[model samples]
Structures are given as structure tokens and as C-alpha cells.
Target chain A: MGVKSTASNNATIFCNSKRFFRKLKEQKYLYMMVIPGIIWMLIFNYIPMYGIIIAFKDYNIISSFFEAPWAGLKHFSDFFKDDWFPIIMKNTVGISLLKLVFGFPLPIIFALFLNEIRNSTFKRTVQTISYLPHFLSWVVLGGIMITWLSESGMINELLVNMGILDKPVAFLGEPKYFWWIATISDIWKGLGWNSIIYLAAISGVDVELYESAIVDGAGRFRRMWSITLPSISGTIAILFILAVSGLLNSNFDQILVLRNSLNASSSEVIDIFVYRMGIQSARFSYATAVGLFKSVIALMLLLLANWVTRKLTGKSLF
Target chain B: MRRKFLARRTKGEVVFDIVNTIIMIVICFMMLYPVWYTLVNSLNDGTDAMLGGIYWWPRVFSLDSYKAVFADSKIFRAFGVSFFRTIIGTVVHVFFTSMVAYGLSKRYLMGRKYFMAMGTVTLFFSGGLIPTFLLYRSLGLLDRFVVYIIPAMFNFYNLLIFQAFFREIPDALEESAKIDGANDFYIFFKIIIPLSKPVLATIALFTGVYHWNDYFAGVIFINNPDLQPIQTFLYRVIAETTSVHMLQNMPAGIRTTSVTSHTIRLATMIVTTAPVICVYPFLQKYFVKGMLLGSIKG
Candidate 1:
């Protein structure tokens, strides 16, 4: 009786597998369309993920990936003990936090103020001009900025002329100014473009909310504070969560272009450290370890941020 | 008449409007002035620009810097690389990402959840730069043009965007096509492709801008000067050169008589940024729409 039942179960399994294959064959085109993407992800993303094992191994150019001897936690420990580790972390967190604190809110304010503008032509023109900087590469902007912040450049000239400085000052040459420069420049590049999302949210707000508020004698400021703010709170929350997760990411391209020997103390963020160690110095294993550490921390931060936002505002990225 | 009456502003509101308008003007000036200053400097005689009081216009008007920039064969080659890469990369990315998005959008597709989970994992974590570089090296992608195209072909964010857009498309349209004996590929090519023009254009612009502006890939992957994109070329010219060193490495065949390194660098900056600035005005709405779509939970 047991043998007979097992045979029937095997027959049913075979029948189910045949039906699945038939369904798959019928929708073969869908499979064909998705296959390229799956293959790409495996080759580009998954392989790299697998290659991250080098962080645990004593990887070198001379040895094949599998042949590399295990180093366990040696590379990670070395990174923590590295002389530049503290400085790198400081700069990364400093610049990223500065941008978050100052750079994040300016866009929401910009969007709100932009929404207040009554004239369409003026509004469109302002928006067009504002977003122009975002499209330009940091290479171009950095080149322009290097000249503008030089001792003899426009910024120094303006400051000196306005009695803000006694003499020309080299803005980029000073390590003290690097964080501010990075943050401000990031804001300048992103302000209008960043505001686009907020503006979209504002446009979606019900017109009747404003009308009813006005009828209730609420001023524009009150309406904006109570109505528009709450309307787009979800967007703000999501973006803030994203910002929190990216706390370690200083703008690599911007920093790389702007950094010189004089500003190295303040400009050496984790991304730069990784680039220098891995690509420049060819300390691949150590760099991979450092990068892995950052990735793990970033993932944890993202999950934590998502959890907090969900708990506080009932909004989550997932 | 009632609407007009209701639109009347209070004294405080009037003051607020004035303040807001002034603020907007200042912001606009702040945004425009740097590029304007760069343009002025680029157009100025290089030696004269060193005197450093030229704020609004080129005091000694000359096109020598631009002339010098245009004269370089390397710059032209780099520009060609940038152009072709942006076009080809955008095309391949839009096609591949949208194809996958459409397939994934089908709720009944086999192993759909697993496929989505695979794509979703990429969003939060990546195998850091060194591993990626190593993987690319092993794949023989380093220093090759296709390195730009293949690795960038499937962005998960873009796939999500396309999936959201594709799902909004009426099932009836696709069902009708299927009833006519059309397969998924044929319907996607014939019907869906035509319908998805806005999203396609939006994604295309985004991917194009990214490719054009990216100097990191060129800096890390491609060592060959001939393969470097224009932005990378500009980065090299700007980052490596001081005024003193510029004289040594000034483009071999050009007369640097009226052009200094600073002015030439500004010219290079202008040239690199010109394509984006020129196209931005017309494409502004689409970019805003793209941002909005991206912000949505896809």
C-alpha cells in the first residue's frame, strides 16, 4: 500500500512538472526578454559580489582569486588601525552631515517659495536657470570653481572689496574651508533639481485645502505651514531617510576634482581613501575590506532609517 | 469678479511677495553668475584675464582660447567618444531595462518574485568599487568602449521606473494584440514601444546626461588617452595643470600667444557644459516629470 501511494505521488509530481514546462514554453518570449537582464546582473553585479570575498583573502595581482590564502579579519583590522582612518571618517561624516543639515532643507524652502511666485514666465525662467548647474559635470564646475576661489579670483576679490577680508584669501587652499565648500557647492548644484520632487508633491495637494484655509482666515504662511507641509511630509521623510543612509558618502567626484595637497587633510573621505588604496596604491585587499566595511554600515543605516521612519511617520521606503 | 476680489493680498502678504521675488532674483543671479563669469573669462584674452577685474564681460575680446581648444585633435576625439557613448549607451540602456521591466510587470510570469528580489538586492548594496573593478578586469572590459555600454545597461532604479510606467499601460491593448496572434516581443516592439515614448525619452535623457558627465569610469577603467571621454579629458587638463605646467603641455600645434592655461581651461569647461546647457531648457519639463516619477514608490 505504501509503494502504490509513493508511485502515485511521483506520477502527480511528473504531471505538474510537464504542465509547468508547457506554460513556460507558451510564454517563452517573456523569458527571452528577461534573460539578458538576468545574465547582466549575474555577470556584473553577482560576480562582483562574489569577488568581495577577496576582502577576506590575501589577494594579490600575482595570485588567482581562488589560490589566494585566507587572511580572515586581518585586512579589516588593518583598516581600523590605519593612521588615516579617523581623519577619513571625520571628513566623510562632516561633509555629509553638513550637507544634510544645511543642504536638505533649502530645497524644500526653495520649492515652497517657488510655488508662491504668481507669474508663470518668471517662475519658469527661475527654474530653468536654477537647474542648469545640476546638468554640468563636476569637472567643468570644479575647474571653474578653482579659478573663482583662487587668491586672485572673483570670490577673494569680492570679499576683499566688500571689507569681509583684509586681503585675498585662497579658499580652496585652506583645509578649514573644505567641508563648507563641498556642502555649499553640492547645494548649489542640486537645489533646483532637488526641489523638483517637492514641487511635484505640492502640485498634487488639493486646491480645496487652500481655498478652505483662506475662507477660514488662515494666512498664506499659516496655510503653507499647516497644509503644504503636512501634504508633502511623506516625501520629506523618505528623502531624509535616504540622506541618513548616505551619511558616509561624500561627493567623490566633487572632492576628487577639488582636492589638492593643501586640502588633503579635510578632503580625504572614505571613497577617496578606497580609490587611493585600491586603484592608486594597488592595496586591493585592504581597500576591498574598507569598502566592505562601509557597505555593511550603509546597509545597516538604511534599514535602521527605514525602521525609524516607519515607526515615527508610518512611512517606509520599502 | 468674485475670484478677483478673493485674490487680493493683505499688507503682510504683499511684503512677503516682495521679499520672495527679491530672493528669487538673488538665487537666479547666484546660479547664473559663475557660468557667466567663466564664459567671460573664456572669451577674454588669456593674458588680460590674469589681471582679474573682468566681472561682466570680456574686456579684451578674443576667441583665441576657443580657437586653441577647437584646434586640438585630442579634444575632438574625446568629444566624439563622449557623443557616441552617450547615444549608444542611452539606447542600449533604455531598450534592455524596458524589456526586462515589461517582463517583470507581468504578474503571472514564472519566478517573478525571485526576479524582483534579485533586482531589489542591488539597490541597497553593491560589491564595492574594488571588487567591481576586479570583476571588470577579469571580464576583459577594462579600457574597452563596451565597458561603458554593458555594465550600465541595467540600472535597477530605471528598471523600476519602466516597470511602473509599463504597468500603467492598459492590459486591453496588449490583450488585443495577443488575440491577433502577436507574441510578447511583437506587441512590445509594435504597440508598447510606441506608447512608452515619454518614459523612454525621460530615461534616455537621464542616462545620456550620466554618460556625458561621468569622468570616473574614464579615470579608472580606460587608461588609453584615445578612449577617454571629453569630461575626463577636461578633468585631466584642469586637475593636473597649473599655470606654469600648462605652458609645457599646451596642445602641441596651437599658438598659445593670447591664451593662458586658465582661459583655456575655462574654454574647455564651457565646451564640455555647452551641450547640457543648450538642451536643458527644452527638456526641463521632462526632467521634472522624471524626478516625480522616480520619487513614486516603484
Candidate 2:
């Protein structure tokens, strides 16, 4: 009985291996097509995942990632105890929430405003021009911003000429106004381009709803409130979830470009802090710790957003 | 078209329409004036621009700023670097991303689910900046040109886009090819790729734009000035407006006679921005298509 069972098990294993090999052979070309990308992802995407271990290690540039001495929770504890932690946290959350509140709604409002335009030519022109800034790099936009915000720039010129201001203000140099500057610049750059989805969402609304509303003597405002906003609410909800989940991001490019020593108090966020600590100061372990903290929080937010979105709208990103 | 249904207007509606049009026109002017501000200053006489009356156009129209940018050998090199990276990076990125997407789209293939998950996992998580920098350092990829191409080859979003596109290509086509004794490689290269042009174009336009605009890679990966893209060079020129670096590594003697630092700054912005802007009209449709497609579930 033992001999028979052993033979049967061996036969089963042999059959499975044969089938697996046949399957591989059948899809060999498809495998070939994707293997390079897989390998690339493994190296660029997955391998660094292993490097996340350095968050707990006293990692040195000279020392290998795994070879570094394990200093359990030292880096994280140090981050918690550091005075800059709260400041960075405050700045990151502050800027993110501000952007979420201000930046998120601007595009929606812009889309609604745009939707009201009866003239296609005018609407198209506004959209095409607005998206131009979105394509421009932070470096260029920063230069543009600096030029505009400069004492001699057009904005100051306009303000001073209009008697709205007593004197030219160095908007970029002040920490107190950095949030507003960042928020406004973000809206300026993205308002049109970000509105594209909402516009598309608005377009997908049933034409009959509007036509019927007009038949019932619904005014433009009333029809908009009844028809357009509700139809596009899904897109808005999805984008809102995405925006909220990205609350920790804090517009790294915009901040980095606009940041200066004077405004560091308001401008320094989690990403900038990580870049400074990790690259500039060579505090790899500490930076990794902070970065890990950010990623963990980001992950939690994403999951929470996805869960909430699924529960409410029956749609999710996962 | 929307106006035909309700041409009759109340005072409130008329007022709202007027306000909306005014707001749009004002916003349009605001958006445009900054680029114009930089432009007029770029073309103005360096000394004249310093006096700050050059608003509508150049006070004494001169080619000084453009000439100065052209004279800077580093700008030339940076442009060449940026141009070459955009071309090669875009091609390699589109090909590999599409190829992977094609493979992952084959749900019946063995282990395809795991492959797709491998991609989706990377979409949500990353190793952050330091570890990536350290890993690149260890791999001797820091400052290398291949660093641009390899790390960016497989974008998960592009992958899903390609997968979604490939799924729409009927299975009957592939089944017929298989019956003809043509393998998946032959089918992909000859049949699938030929039919995949629209999606390919959309991906190419976006990833190309990304490559052209990227300087964060240079900021983190490469410290060599020679290896820096035009964007990074402009970034430095903008950030360090007062430094000697603004003078294009030229001899100090030429500095006093050259364009003002501000003029040079505008010129740099123009030179960096114009390439992308030039292609915008041609590729704008593809991006709109691509972006909307992204919002839809794959």
C-alpha cells in the first residue's frame, strides 16, 4: 500500500511539472515581450523596496544596505524626538489641507464656469491657454512667478499703479504669505488642465436632463444645480479622494522651486525635509525614517479613501 | 449651441453672463501677460530693462539675450542632452511599456495575474528618495545617461493603458494568426504593433513630455554639469540669479558688457519652454484622449 501511494504521488508531481512546462512553452513569446520590463521593474521598483530596511539601520554611504548595523527603532525615535519633526509636519499638513480646500475647488468652479460658455471658440481658447502652464516645468513656472512677484514685476507695478498698495511687497520673501502664494500659483497652473476631467464628466451628463429642465422653465442656474453638478459628482468625488490621499505630497516641485532660506519656516514640508536630511546632510537613516513615516501614512490614507469611496459610490481605485 | 434652448434672458442671467465673460477674459489676460512680461524683457536692451519701463515691447529691441544664450556652450550642450534624451527616452519608454502591457493583457497566459499585480503594487508604493539614490549609487548608475532610460522604462499607468487598448483588439485576429503557425512574437511585431499606433502615439506624447520636463533626475542622480539637462541648467540660472554661474562659465570680462542677469533669465526660460510649446499644438489631442482614458476604469 505504501509503495503504491508513493508511485501515485510521484506520478502526480511529474504530470504537474509537465503541464507547467507546456504552459510556459505555449506563451514563450509573450513572456519574452514582457521579461525586460519585468526585470526593469524588479531592479528600479522592487529592489529599492529592500532598501527601505535602511530606515531601521544606521546606513552609511560606504556601507552596503544590508551590511549596515541594525539599530532598531533608533532612526524613527530620533525623528520623533527631533524638534524639526513637528514643524515639518505642521507645514506639510498645513499646505496640503490649504491646497485641498482651495486648489481642489478652483478647478471644479473653473469647469462649471467654462461649461456656461456658449461660444465654443472662446471656451476652447481658454482651455488651451490654461493647460499651457500645466505643461511648463516648475523651474520655468518658478522663474515666471519670481518675475511676476518681483518688486519691479508686473503684479507689483499694477498694484502700485492702482493705489491698492502703499509700497511694493516682496511676496516671495515673506513666510506668512507663502501658503497663499503656493496655493494661488498652483491654481493658476492647474485650473484649466485639471478641469478637463470635470468638463468630460459634465459632457457625459444626459442631454435630456437639461432639455427637460428647460421645458419645465428651469433657469440656467437652477438647471446647472439640478443637472450638471449631480452628474459630475462622481468625478469630483474620485478626484477629491485622490487629492485627500495625496495630502502629504505638498507640491514638492513648486515648494522646492519657490523655497528660500527666508521663507523656510513656512515652506519646508516633509519632502523638502527628507531631501535636505538625506542628500544634503548625508543623514540617510534619518531621512529614510521620515520617508517611511510618510509612506505609511500615505498608504493608510489611500486605503481609507478607497474604502470610503467604495462604500459610498460603489467605485474604487484598487 | 446651449444658448438656443433658452435665448430669453432675465437681468440676473444677463449680469451673470457678463461677469462670467469678464472673468474669463481677465483670467486669459492674466495667464498670457506673464509670458509676455518675460518676453518683452528678454528682448529689451539690458540696461533699459533695468530701468523697468519696458512693458508693451522691448524699449530698444536687441538680439542680445538670445545671442548670449547661443554663445553659452553649456546651453548648447544642455539642449543637445535634452533633445537626445527626449527622443531616445520616449522611444524606449513607449516600446517597453507597450510590450509589457501587451503581455499582461493576455489573461489566459500562465502567471499573468502575478505580473499585473507586480505592476499595480509599484503604482502605490516606492522606496522614497534616499534609498533610490543610494541604490543608484551602488549600481554605478549615478550620472549615467542610461539612468534616464532604464528607470523610466516601465510605467504602470502606461502599462494598464496599453493592456486596455490591446484587449479591444479582437481575439479572433490572434486566433487566426495562431492557426497560421505564426507565434506571439511574430503576431505582436507584425500585427499588434501595426494596429496599436493611436495608443502608442498617446503614450509617446505624454512620456516624451515627462522626459523633456524632468530635471529631478539630474538633481538627484547626476552632479556633473556636463550631464545636466537644460531644465536643471535653467533651474540653477533662476535659483542663483546673482552667482557667477549666471554668466555661462564665461570669463569675468564679458560679464559687464553682456545682457543683464534678468534678461538672461528670461531668455533661458524661453529657450527651455519653447521646445515643449512648439510641440503642444501637434500633440494636444493625444494627451486629452490619454488623460480621459486614464480616468475610465481599465
Candidate 3:
């Protein structure tokens, strides 16, 4: 019996190997098509992984990577001990939370409101105009915002004219107002564009559900509340999961352009911090450690969010 | 009673329509006001713009800003660089992304699951900016146009959308092509390519917009001013508002002499954004459809 079983297992292994080789030969062209992509990824994505070792070493441009002496945990400790660490953390988390609270819901609300409009023309116009800002680079938009918010700019002039204030408020120059302004500007830029997904999801909701509700004496509001919202609940959940995953991402480009020395206290996020320290200061190792730290945290949060969604809602990002 | 109910319903509908129109118009103004402000301000006389006199209309309309922008040889060169880079970068990005996406779309493809897992891992985790910079440097790609194209070639999300679209194509098409002894490449180009025009067009527009608007990569990778794209050039104009040297060699008495320092900033912005805005309307239908299709699902 043992000899027979051994022979059967060996035969199975041989068969699998033969099938694999045959499959490889048959799909050789497909494999060839994937070569450039794989090579690009390996060169640009994978090779950079070796540089992560610099986080542990006292890396310097003059010394070879291998010759750089290891200083395990020193960079990490230095980052934690830095005077600006808390400020940066506070700004990053503060801005992220504000975006989550304000920017996330803006699109959802806009979509819901837009869904109620019966006029297709108006809907498309609103969508087009709203989405225009998203296409404009932050560099340009930043200039626009500065012009509008400057002491002599439109907003201040309007406010003063309305007798809302005796003097013009320096909106961008003040630290206290910077975060709020950033959040509002972000919402303004993305509200329409971000809502496109939700609108699509709303459109995907079965028309029959609305018809049945109407037959049951449901008003427009009731039908929307019961039918439209529930139909796109899955999409909302998925987007929420995605948003939670990137709780650390505060949009570096937006902040970088919007930032000034006066508002740096409120505007600096992890990405901007890493840019300033790593790229500007040339503390490559320390910056990598901080960035790696953020990426790891974000990944862990993503997995946790996915796990929780799977457990509670029976849906996962995967 | 029936007449009364019909009248009430019609009245409610009328009210809703009016309210909706008003709200939409207000939102449109809010959306467009900033852009309009920039445009009008750019065209206004420099001193008038500085005094915040121009709002809904240009106080003293002038083509000086436009002339100022075109007068500079650097702006023209940068525009050419941007156009070339966008064309090459977008084409390469779409081709590689679609090819890989097509390969991965097949269920029977070996190592599909592993490849997918690897792709997903990249979506959430990267080796950080420092490492990526070092990697690019080591490859002798830094400061090259290839640096702009290679790193961002395969956006995994876009690839997934293409893969999904390819998977939806009827299998019988490939089966019949196979029976005719058509090779995979032949089938991909001859059959699949023709069928996938919507997605191809969508990806092209999307990639084009991304590459055109990108200045971050240019700032980090390209040290030479000559190689800088339009966005980077505009960024410099904004960041260093006082530097007339950047705009030197313009037609005499064009933008350099007339536009206020602040209006110059706005003018540069308007110049950079106008091309994108012009291209948008033509592509809006496909662009929105593509975004919806790509984003609505996983």
C-alpha cells in the first residue's frame, strides 16, 4: 500500500510540472507583453527598497551605503525628540480629521442633493463647474485663493462692506484661520468631482425600487430616503474604508502651496514635513524613517479597517 | 378631489423646479467666481488689479498679460516641452498599463493571483520618497524625461479598470480568433484593441490630464530649467513673483512692462489653466463616464 501511494504522489507531482511547462509555452507571448511592466516595477518600485536600509544607517552622500555605520533606532529617536515633531503631528492629524469631517461629507451631501434635482441639464452644469477646480493645479488655485483672501482681496473687502468687520481680516496670514480655510478650499475644489462616484452609484440604484415605493404612496423625499440611500450604502461603505485607510494623507500639494511661514504651524502635514526635512534638509535617513513610519501606520489602519468591515458588514476592500 | 390632488402635485413640482434652478445657479457662480476673478484680474491693468477694483469685469481690458506670456521665449519653450512630455508620457502610460491589464484579465493566466496581490501591496505601501529618489538616481533616470514617464506608468487603479473592462469582453471572440491560428499579440491588437476604444479613449484623456498638470515630479527630478514643463514654469512664476528676468526677452512693452506684479501671477495661472479648460469640454462626456466606470466599482 505504501509503495502504491508513493508512486501515485510522484505521478501527480510530475503531471503538475508538465502542465505548468505546457501552460508557460502556450502563454509565452502574454508573458512577453508583461515584461516591460515587470521590469519597470522592479527598477522603480522594488530596487528602491534597498535604500530603506538607510533608515538604520548613518547615511551620508560621501560614504558608500555598505560603509555607512549602522545606528539602529537613532534616527527614529531623533525624530520623536525633535521640537517640531509634536507640531507636525498635530497639524497632520488636525488637517486630516478636518478633511474627513468636512470634505468627506461635502461630496456625499452634494450628491444626495444633486440626485434630487429633476433637471438633468442643471445637474450636469453643476457637476462640470464644480469639477473644474479639481483639474486646475493647486499652484494656480493657491494663487487664486491668496488673491481672494488677502487683506485687500475680495473676501475681506466684501466682509468689510457688509459691516461684518471694521477692518479686513488677514485670512491666509493668520495661523488660526489657516486650517479652516484649507478645509473649506479643499471642499470647494473637490465637492463636485468627488461626488461623481456617488452620483453614479445613485444612478445604479434600481428604478423598480423607486416605482414600487411610489406605488406604496411614498413621496419623493421618502422614496429617496428609503430607496436611493440604501442602494448606494455599499459604495459609501467602500469609500469610507478607503478614506480611513488614508487617514494620514492630508494632500501634500495643496498644503505645500498654501503654506507660508505664518501658517506653517497649522498647515504642515506628514508629507510636507517629510518633504521639508528629507528633501530640503538632506536628512534622507531620518525622513525615510518618518515616511516609513507613516506608511506602515496607514497600511495597518487599512488592514484593520478592512478586517472590521469584513467582520461587521461582511465586506472587505480586497 | 382628484382635480384638487393633481393641482397640489403640480404646484409642488413647480416649487421644486424653481428652487432647484436657483440653487444650481448660485452653486455655479460659486464654482466659477474664482476662475472668473483670476481671468478678469489677469486682463486688467496692473495698478487697477492691485487696488482690487476689478471684480466681475476688467476695469481696463488689455491684452498685455497674454502678450507678456507669449513674449517670453522660455514660456514658449516650456509649453513645447510640456506638450511633448504629455504626449509621450501619456502614450507610454496607457500602452503599458493596458497591456499588463489585458494580460492579468484572463482567469486562467498563471500566477495571476500572486501578481494581483503584489499590485495591491503597492497600492498601500511604498518604499518612501527617499528610497524612490535614490532608486531613480542609481538608474541614471534622474533629470531625464524618462523619469517623468517611468515612475508613474502603471497606475494600479487604472490598470484594474482596464482589466475589468477586458474581462467583460465575450470569450467567444478570443476563442474564434484562436481557432484561426491568430497569435495572442495579433488577437490583442486586431480584435481587443478595436473593441476597447471607450476605455482606451478614457485612459488617454485621464493620463494626459495627469501628466500635463504634474509639476511635483518635475520639481524633484528635473534640475535643468530648459527641461522644465509648463506647470513647473508657472510654479516658478508664482513662487517668485518679482523675477522679471524669467519673463525677459518678451516683445518690447508687452506683459513685462504693463501687468502689475500681482496680476502677472494671476496671468501666468490663467495661461497655464486655459489649455486644460479648453480640452475639457470636448472630452467631458467620455471623461465623466470613464471616472464613473472606474470609481463606482471596487
Candidate 4:
């Protein structure tokens, strides 16, 4: 009786396997289409994920990355214990917060005012000019900025001649001004491009709202504040949550371009710290530990922000 | 009634419009002047540029900087590397990403949920820099041209963009193709792809621009100067020349050149930036449409 039941079970398993193959064969082309991408993802993305174990290991060039001896949180504890930890953490959190305060609102304000423009040509020109910088790599912009902010460059010349300064000051050379420059430049590069979403959101608001506001003798500013702002608040909430979640990134490209030894005190942030420690100096384990710490924090922040956003605004990234 | 309303403007409203227009014009000037300043400086004689009076227009109107930038053998090779990766990277990105999106867009495709979850999980979490770098090193990708194109072939965001686009094709379109005995592959190639030109162009533009602009990958993966892209090469030049003493210490080619480091910097900037800015207007409409669709749909 036991043998007979086992045979029937084997038969049923075989039948299920055949049906699975037949269904797969029916959409064989679709399967073929997706196979390469999945394979690529598996290699380039997922495989690297397993490499995260290096953070807990004493990894080096001689030893295989996976086979390296486990250090078990030694790297993580070492990073937190390091003297430069406070400086980098402060710089990262400070710059990100400043950017959140200054950079976040410029685009929204620009979009709001831009919507008031009656002339389509003027609006289009402003938009085109504004977004042009967004396309130019920071390598170009940073080079331009170096020249512009030079002691003898246009900015210094204008300030000295205007009598706003006794002499040309090296803006990039000073630590006090570095944060503002980073934040302002971030806004400058992204303001117009970022406004595209808000502008899109505003466009979807009912046209009759505007017409009725006109009937009610409401001014443009009044209509904007009462109707437009409220309409796009959902988008603002979503983006704000995403931005808060990304506060750890601090835009390595921008810092790498703009930073020098003179301003490294203020400019050195988490991502730059990782690059210097990991790629440049080849402190692989410590860098991975720092990176893993940052990733975990970022994930927590995202979840927290999403929760807060839903609680406060009835909208969330999720 | 229309004529009367057009003729009437409250004094305050008129004043507000005038103020708004003036502010807009000033903003426009502020936005344009930085790029304009760079062009003026780029065109001026390098030595004259150092004297600091040049503004609004080139003072000496010399093309020596441009000539010098072109004369550099490294710049030529860098440009070649940049162009090669951009074209190849963008094509592979659009092609495979589209295929994957097409598969996902089909409602009846098996294991779609698992496939989607696999891709989506990556958006939030990743093995950090060390792991990714080590993986590349282990795979023998470092210092090779394949480093730029391979790792970036399947952008998760672009996958969503492609999926959103593919999902929009009316069901009837695919149904008719199926009824005519065309398989999924045939319909995707002959029908969906031709109709997806706008989206494909948009994704291509994004991927192409990314390849053009990215120096971070080159910084991490490629150590050889010959394999470096234009941006990375320019970054090296900028980093080296920031200290005057360093430039003086450099091999004679840069120090002996007639062009100032400032002018050389400007020329390099223009060389790297011009192509993207020039091609921008043609891609602008599609870019906006793509951004809107991706944002709204995602």
C-alpha cells in the first residue's frame, strides 16, 4: 500500500512539471525577452549585494573577498570610533538640511510665479534658459565656477568695484561660505528642472477654479495661494519624503567637483568619505561598513518619512 | 463686453505685471550670464583673459584656446572614448530595458510579480561602494571600456519608463497582431517598437546623456588615462591645475602652451558641454513628456 501511494505521488509531481513546461513554452518568446535583463540584474546588481559581507570581514587583495576572515562588526565599531566621524557626519547632515531648507522651496516658488506669466513665449524662454544648466555636467559648471569665483574673476571684480568689499575675497577658500555655495549651486542647477513636476501638477488643477476665482474678484496671488498651492501639496509631500530619505547622499558629484583641500573641512560628507576611504585609499572593509551603516540609516529614514507623510498629509511615497 | 474687459486694467494689477516682467527679465539675465561669461572668456586671448577686464565679449577674440584643446592628443582619445560608450551604452540600455518592460507589461506572463519585486527591491537597497567595486574588480571589469556600458545596461527607472510606455498601447493592437498569427516577439519588433519611437528616443537621450556626463564610473573603474572619458580627463586637468605650483611642475606641454589654464579650462568645458546643449532643444519635448509620464505613472 505504501509503495503504491509513493508511485502515485511521483506521477502527480511529473504531471505538474509537464504542465509547467507547457505553459512556459506557450510564452517562450516573452520568457526569452526577459531572460537577458534578469541575468544582467543578477550579475551586476544582486551579486554585488552578497559582497556586502565584506563589511564584516578583514577583506584585502590577497584573500578572496568572500573567503576573507570575519571581523564581526569590528569595522563598524572602528568607523564610529574614528576621530573624523563627527566632522563627516556633521557636514553631511548640515549640508543636507541646509539644502532641504533653501533648495527645496526655490523650484516650487519658481513654478508658482512662472504659472502667473501670461506670455507663453516669455515663460518658455525662461524655462529653456533655466534648465540649460541642468544638462551641463558639473565638470563644465565647476570649471566655469572656479574661474568666476577667482579673486580676479567677474564676481570679485564686480564686488570690489561696487565698494561692497575692501578687496577680492576667495569665496571657495573660506570654510564659512562653502555650505552656502554648495546649497545655492544645487538650487541653481536644479530649480527649473525640478519645477517641471509642480508645474505639471498645477496644470492638472481645474481651469474652472481659476475662472470662478476671477468671478469672485480674487487676485492672481490670492488664487495661487488658495487654490494652486493646496492642489500641489501632495506632490510636495511625496518629493519632500524622498528628499529627506536621500539626505545621506549629499551629492558626491557636486562635492567632488567643488571640493578642494581648502574647503574639505566643510565639504567632506558621507559619500565623499566613502569614495576616499574605499576607492582612493582602498580601505575596503571600513568603507563598506560605513556604506552599510548609511544604507541602513537611509532605509530607516525612508520608512519614517513615509509614515510621517501619510500621517500628516494623507499621502506617502509607498 | 470683451473689448471693455480687455481695455480695463486696475492700477495695482498693471503695476504688478510690470514688476513681474522686470523681475523675470532680471532672472533671465542672471540665468544666462554665467554661460555667456564662459563663452566670452573661452574666446578671449588666454593672457589677456588673465588681466580680468573681459566681460560681455571677448577682448582679443583669439581661437588659440580652441586650437590648443584640439591639438591635445589626450582630448581626442577622451572624446572617442566618450562617444563610443555613449552610443553603445544607450543602445543596449534602450533595447534590453524595453524587452524586459515588454515582458512585464504582458498581463499573462508568468512570475511577473517575482520579477518586478526583484527589480524594485534594488531601488532602495544596495551593496555599497566597496562591494560593487570589488565585484567589478573580481569580474575583471576595471580599466576596461565594458565597465561603463555593462553595469548600467538595465536602469531600474528607465525600466519603469519603458513599462509605462508599453502598457499604454491599446490591447486591441496586440490582439489584432495575435489573431493574425504573429507571436509576441514578432508583434513587439514590428508593431510595439515602431509605435514606441518617442519613448525610445527619450530613454536613449537620458542614457546617452548619462554616459556622456558620468565621470564617477570612470574614476572608480578605469585607471588608465587612455581609457578615460572626456569628463574624467577634464576632471584630472582641473584637479591638477587648481594649485599654480602643480601646473608649473607638470610636464612642459601644459606649462609651455600659449593658452592660459583658465582658457584651457574654458575650452575643455565647452568641448564637453556643447554637444549636449546643442542637441537639447530637439529632445526637449520628448524629455518633458517622458518625465511627466514616468513621474505620474510611477
Q: Give one digit per residue, the lDDT tens place, for model 4 in A68-187.
A: 999999999999999889999999999999999988988999899888777889988888877888898877777777777767778899999999999998787787888888898888
- Highest-lDDT candidate: 1
> Residues A78-157, candidate 1, lDDT per residue (tens digit)?
99999999999999999999999999999999999999888889998999889988998999888888888888888998
Q: Candidate 3 lDDT, tens digit per residue, A1-318?
A: 585457557677677788678889999888877766767666666666667888898887667557889999998999899888899899888888898899888788778878877667878878888788888888888778777787888998889989998999877778899789888889888988889889888988877776666558777667767888878877777888888888898787778767777677787788988888887788888998888888888988888888888887776777
Off by over 4 Å in 3: A1-19, A63-67, A215-218, A308-314, B1-16, B240-257
Q: What tens digits encode model 2's per-residue C-alpha lDDT throughout A185-304?
A: 898889888999999999888888888887798877897788898888878778877887898988887888888776788989999999999999999999999998999999899889
Tens digits of lDDT, candidate 1, B173-281: 9999899999999999999999999899899999999999999999999999999999999888776663333345556556556888778788888988999889989
Clashing pairs in 3: B68-B255
What lDDT does the true structure give each of the candidates? Answer: 0.89, 0.84, 0.80, 0.85
The TM-score obtained by model 3 is: 0.92
Q: For model 4, which pairs clash?
A: none
Query: Residue B202 CA error for candidate 1 (Å)?
Result: 0.2
Chain A alone, TM-score per model = 0.94, 0.92, 0.90, 0.94
- Residue B250 displacement (Å), model 1: 2.3
**lDDT (0-100) at residue B27 of candidate 3?**
78
The docking category that best describes candidate 1 is medium
Instruction: Spell out the clash pairs found in candidate 1.
Output: none
TM-score ranking, high to low: 1, 4, 2, 3
Tens digit of lDDT per residue, candidate 4, span B1-298?
4344336667877887788888778877877788888888889888888888788899889888888788878888899999999999999889889988898888778898888899998888998788899888989999999999889889777888888888888999999989999999899999999999999999999889899999888778899989999999888777545645224422246533347877877887887888998999778888888888888755
Model 3 lDDT at residue B77: 86
